[model samples]
Target: MSKKILISIPIFILAILSPVAPIFYFGLNTKKIDANIQRLLKYSWFDELYSTDKFRHLFFANKHVRKKLSSDIYVKLLSHHKKTQEKFYRFLEKENNRSN
Candidate 1:
């Protein structure tokens, strides 16, 4: 009886802690994912490709497509593109005014 109680106690403790394992795993994965994303974001070619209208259309066209794009990462890329485009247009406008 004592041996059975000892085995059951460890088993019960393990069952209780099992759910926490995935949470820790995912937390570590999230950091790695974020790091990889940041590295990818630094490339100009990646920026150009992500900024295209076709990419935007495909990203928003369907659930499966959006999932493939990893919506969170794509959204952040789109936002960065938006800000960069705005800055470029502002610079162009300033240049045009100077030339006038």
Candidate 2:
């Protein structure tokens, strides 16, 4: 029992951390974080885990592996993504406005 508990502890920790891997991977790169997240979110598994499904039927979630996340997770992810893209998006908007 003791040995099983010890072995399972690390596995549990890894399972929790694995879903948010992209956040850790490109966190430091502000210049590319938005693009990185945009790409990662297109993957069904990753997007479901983060609960960024724009359409319910689009993301095929595996309930057996893990329950789908709540909108809170998506909200937080969107907040972070928007923060990173703010300057770039604003610049684009400004350029379009000036041209018009």
The per-model lDDT (C-alpha) reads: 0.51, 0.46
Clashes of 2: 0
Query: Clashes in model 1: which pairs?
Result: none
lDDT of 2 by residue, 1-100 (tens): 6999999999999899998875577343332434544555775544653463333322233221112122335424544675633443343345444545
Could you give candidate 1's per-residue lDDT for residues 1-100 as a string of tens digits? Answer: 6999989998998899898876555433434444544554576754564466544343234333334234456535544686754554354345444545
Give model 2's TM-score versus the native structure: 0.28
| TM-score for all models, in order of appearance | 0.34, 0.28
Per TM-score, the best of the predicted structures is 1
Q: Which stretches of candidate 1 lie over 4 Å from their true place?
A: 25-27, 39-100
